[model samples]
Target: MILSVALSASLALTGSPAHAATKPVTFQGFTIQVPIQWHAKKEGVNLRVITGVCSPQAAECQSFLLGGPQAVKYASEGGPYRPDQPYHPSSGVTECVPVKKYNSGQATRVRTSKAVFGAGQRARFTEWKVSCDGSELNVASYTQRVWYVKAKKVIVVDHWKTPGLGGILAKAVWS
Candidate 1:
């Protein structure tokens, strides 16, 4: 009884299998694990899916974008869209440039940095701070981790930045 109790305590402290709350999901040609509260939706004609913290229709939301085929080709910089090519990390860094609007009483500020994605993969982290003439303001930040998994012919984008999004992406399984 003492041994069992000790083992249970250790598992709880280490976040063992019993403590993991995520569920496995298969999309496009890869599989990943996500929290039960999160939901996935198919977006665009291409093999793209957006998993959000809330329902897709929710007003305030953030999501992870998973794209297939052509998306991988377009992920690289300095090249035309070529569905047959893979993404090259050395090509260039992705930027987060939001166009400033004309007198909309709203201004947006974007900040970009380098962050680690799943398994130490380099990713672009962007924060968009939007404020209006009024007292209301919003800051949205997400990490776009794009990689061309040649075997799968897809470029998975783990667009994290919201609460719990990074944890979900950290445990993601591409296969």
Candidate 2:
């Protein structure tokens, strides 16, 4: 009886194993474990992961994208998307901020570092701060986090600031 009580306490303290609560999501030969509640869909050459509430009309919604080489090649309507450059999907203005009537302008790189993915793969991690301007002045700002694996031609872009995402990527298992 004492042993059973102690075992229950230990399990309660440590919680369940991470994998028990998560589901593996694979994209472009890379795999990461995300919460089971998250939904994923294929959009062209990219895998779109919806993490939160999103609107159909919103230009940028509450989600992230895992892109392959083909997706990168045509990320921008005007030209190819470069990891070093700011994320501009089109030449025209895009409403990135959740608030209506606000338009996004040039995004500036705020941070850059090396991020590890499945196995021992290293990626260029960049955080961009994009300003959202109203008709008169800047209304708000948001960060765009990107992990680019040049060797595998895979990129992960996140604008919703999903919790524990970096750690999840770090613990990924590549296939």
Structural similarity to truth (TM-score) of each candidate: 0.43, 0.81
- lDDT (CA) for every model shown? 0.46, 0.78
Clashing pairs in model 2, backbone N/Cα/C closer than 3 A: none
Candidate 1 residue-wise lDDT, 1-175, digit = tens: 9999999898878677546677766766445677665666666634333345444323223555666665655554544333323222226433221212211123233544554445534444444333322233442222333443444554554434445554554555544
Cα-based RMSD of candidate 1: 9.4
Question: Distance from true position, residue 79, model 2, in Å?
Answer: 2.7
Candidate 2 lDDT tens digits, 19-108: 347788988887888888888988876789988887764565688888888766665655677767765566787776555456776678
In TM-score terms, which candidate is top?
2
User: Against the true structure, whose lDDT is highest?
Assistant: 2
